[model samples]
Target chain A: MKTAALILSAVLAVAACVFLLAPLVVVVLASFSPTPVFDLPTTGASLRWYGRIANLEGFWPALGLSIEVAAVSTALALVVGTLAAIAAVRGALPYADAFAALLVSPLMMPGLVLGIALLQYFRAVGFDAPLAGLLVAHLIVTLPYVARTMIAGLSRFDFTLIDAALTLGCTWRQAIFKVMVPALAPSFLIAGLFAFLASFDNYPVSIFLTDVRTKTLPIKMLQYIEEAPDPTIAAVSSLILLGTIVLLIIADRAVGLSRMAGTSD
Target chain B: MPVTSLSRRTLLKASAALAGTVAMPSIVRAAPKEIVIGGPAGAAKYFNESVFPLLKQKLGVTVLYEGTNSLTNLQKMQADKAAPKFSVVIMDDPVMIRAAAEGLIVPMQASAIPNLGKLVPGAVHLDGMWANYQLPWAGIAYNTKSGAPTSWADMWAPSHKGKVIVPSIQNTEGFWNLLIAAHLETGKPLAEAQYDIDAGFRKLKSLVPSLLNVYTNAPQAMNLLEQGEADMIGGQFSAYTLTRKMDGAPVDLAIPKEGGFAMPSGIAKITGGPASDLADAVIDAFLGPDVQQVLATKAVVTPTNLTTPRPAGYPDPATLFAPDWGFVAKERGKWAERWTTELL
Candidate 1:
């Protein structure tokens, strides 16, 4: 009975992986097609579509804007979210669970609803700066990922180690720096990764906030797809997929894959 | 779990360093001497590649094109009313009328654009607040294998039922579909179709059995046609059919003998802008006979300027019916709800 269950579980896991990765494999193959349309190449693969990616009107500026927004928002969310997590876990304020849920509520709201609401709110409040609006919107989008991961990390932590270090030889600040920070390193990495990825690929929210001079990569890609339905979008997706894989590999090497996968818990 | 014995100070330092690298310089550059134009994304590539250089040479001012859907453009215009961003806006005739009514755009002086006289009377809309440079018709786009559908009633035939895609009322083309249905049902000229809403909705409901799906946009309809999922598409833009056919797709547009609806696309000047003279010059260039001819041949739209001859393959502009866009615009909200309830 045990053997049968083990075999069934193994088969299910493999099937799940295939189901998730099949579309990605098709996208990668379509990217290399020599044709101008969205057909997979039956004869020979070509890099023509990849070559056209750089020439897409406004490609460079959009890429630059996307990276900047993602990096800045991720950094800001990490600091703010980590501090909020610490307060909720250690400070033991009244209604701490409610506070945490409020912080993460943006995740549950539909992105289009959030976008339209933000657009109307910004207009009502007389906020006209496009880049600043985009940054704030992305920060809202990314904060939940950081806060959720950090809260989980902090709940399982033992704060007694910091007190022990203080009694031994270190000051309060020194104890936090010496013990708590290193112990939460995996959480920090995982949270930052998720936060950055979320901000980088956001579309529905960015669409409402962006003006002509300021557009994110996802918005620009949508425009490209509408203007011309070609293999160039597939090429861009393939590159993004490749970059994500590299990021995941580095993450797995830094913290054991099982821990990053949250399997041990 | 065995924790790695890494120094907390080192991790903190590394994170701080990573944060530091993300700092962006907030440099404000001088605004350029450029006229900003807002329009649809599907037309942006054509404008940038073919029209910008012409505008620069003719008007001696740089051009910046911002691409977005027409409905979003209307919202943006409303939001930016205090300090309008676009020098010139391009949209369907109905949207231009709505914008004019909201005081978002200003009417043009005939003397400012002399080329306006060159266009046919039907091409001028909203009391010269805007002028239609291109006439993109809405009709049935069909696969060659569908035995060549030639009339709107062809969609309701037993053989064609369940193999047709119609645009949702939210799209400009969808509004045209409503007008066409009204025209056919009432046997009224397209101009008179606006007043018979009941007849239109009843006719639209009658065709419900033919619908494969109601698409919300042009691209989705085009995709369905390209994939052969639908044998014919109702209220599709002729330009998209032309583009697909040029790309080797076995598709052709059919402007039924009952007549198709002509959607006049035009450019309007925003109420306040520093580049009014340049914007006027650009609009005139767009209306020039040579430019109109180029638009007809290259973009597959019917030219509005009478002097510019029609392209060989396209339907004649005079033959297509013109719906009352102003009336349609005013009644669109209630009609859209009716469409959803009765048709979809």
Candidate 2:
């Protein structure tokens, strides 16, 4: 009976992985398809679609904008979200739970609703800068991921370590930099990763804010699909998937994947 | 020290006020000699690749193209109505009607666009607020291996049962499908039969059994036909079908004996936009013979210009159905609701 249970559990886990990973595998295969139509490459592979990705209309600018927005928004959200998490967990502020909920409330709202509301609010406030509006909206989108992870991390933290460091003749800033930050390093990395990915691939909010010249990678990919349904978009998707894998590998090297997965210390 | 602090605060306030006055207008102001045009992604791709360079060379005007669907463009226009961003917009005829009604677009001066006079009849709106640059007809697209279908009624034939893919009513092709059904049911000319929505719904209800599935995306439907998973796709555009055929898909668009509907891609200038002359010039260039030829051959659309000869292998324009778009604009909501409840 014990052997059967272990086998059954292992089988289910493999099935789940396949279910999640099959589409990604298909996309990677389709990127190398020799034909223009999106089909499995029974006719053998070619690098034609990959070569075409660079010449796609407005491809480079869209990629640059997506990276810039994701990097900036993730950086800002980390600072703001980490500080807010500390306040809620350690400051003994009144209504801390409510404040935390409010910080993460945007996550519960539908992206379309949030996008429309932000577009309207910006219009009403006479904010006509598309790039600025996009960054601010992305900050709102990324903050929830950071705050949720940081709050969970801070809850498990030992605040007395910072007090001990201060008693050892360290200044308050030095104690925090030397003790608290390093202790919470894994959470920071995971939160930043999640926040960056969230902002990077956002479509609904970005769509509302993007103008003629300003578009993110997801919006550009959608436009390419609309323009012509071909394997070029699959190539773009495959590259993005590969990039995400590299990021994960680097994160794993910095901190154990198990820690990021929250399965073990 | 108090006086120094007060003076510094005063200096900061004055500088901030000065900066606001200088920066606000520049943010809102349109760049001179540049016109932003919004339209579908495919059409924008064509213009960006072929037409914009010509406009730049001939008129020295820079064109910025915004590529999205028509309804989104309408919403963007509405949001930016106070200080409009788009100098020109291209939309489907139904959406163009709504845009005109909402005062989002103003009529083009005929004198400003000499090429407007050269468009085929029914290519320009009655009010002259917009003109069709390309005519993509909606008809049956079938896999060549199954042989060509000759009439819209052929969809209901026993042989094609459970082998046809009709578009979901959310797509404009679905509306065209309903109209085709109406034309068949009433046995009247398409122009007159299109008004009888009840008969159309009744006819489409009978076609439900023959349908394999309802598709929302055109390319996916084309893929099914190419793979021979489906025999026919009802109400697909000629341009898209022909483009696929040219790309070696085993598919062809057929204009049935009853006639196909013209889903004209319409262009219009935005109201109260900057660089009105440049916008007009862009419209003229779009309608001119050279650009129209490129539209026909490269973009695979039927050019609206009368001077531009129809490309070989395209269906004649005269046989195609041209609906009263005003009626469609008014009744679309009701028909969509009926389509959802009754058909889906």
Fraction of native contacts (fnat) of each candidate: 0.21, 0.29
Clashing pairs in 1: none
lDDT of 2 by residue, A1-265 (tens): 9999999999999999999999999999989988777777888999999999888878997898888789778877888798789888987999999999999999999999999999999989989878779988999999999999999999999999888998999777677779988999989999999999999999999988987767889998888887766788999999999999999999999988998888985
Q: DockQ score of candidate 1?
A: 0.25
| Model 1, backbone clash pairs (residues 3+ apart or across chains), number | 0
Residues B158-201 of candidate 1 have per-residue lDDT tens digits of 88778899877766888766777787899987777768988889
Q: Can you write out model 2's per-residue Cα lDDT over B87-199, one digit (the tens) per residue?
A: 99998888899999999999987899999999998888956899999888778999999999999899999999999999876565677788888878888777778898888
Instruction: Kindly list the per-residue Cα lDDT of model 1 for residues A1-265, writing each as its tens digit.
Output: 9999999999999999999999999899989987555666676999998998888887888898899889878888988788788878877889999999998999999999999999999989989878878888998999999999999999999989987998898876777778988999999999999999999999989989987778889998888887766678999999999898999999999987788778976
Position B42, candidate 1: lDDT: 70
Model 1 misplacement above 4 A: A29-47, A92-99, A154-183, B1-30, B56-64, B145-147, B183-197, B289-294, B306-309
Q: Which one is best on DockQ?
A: 2
Model 2, which residues run further than 4 Å from truth? A167-171, B1-32, B168-172
Check candidate 2 and list the clashing pairs.
none
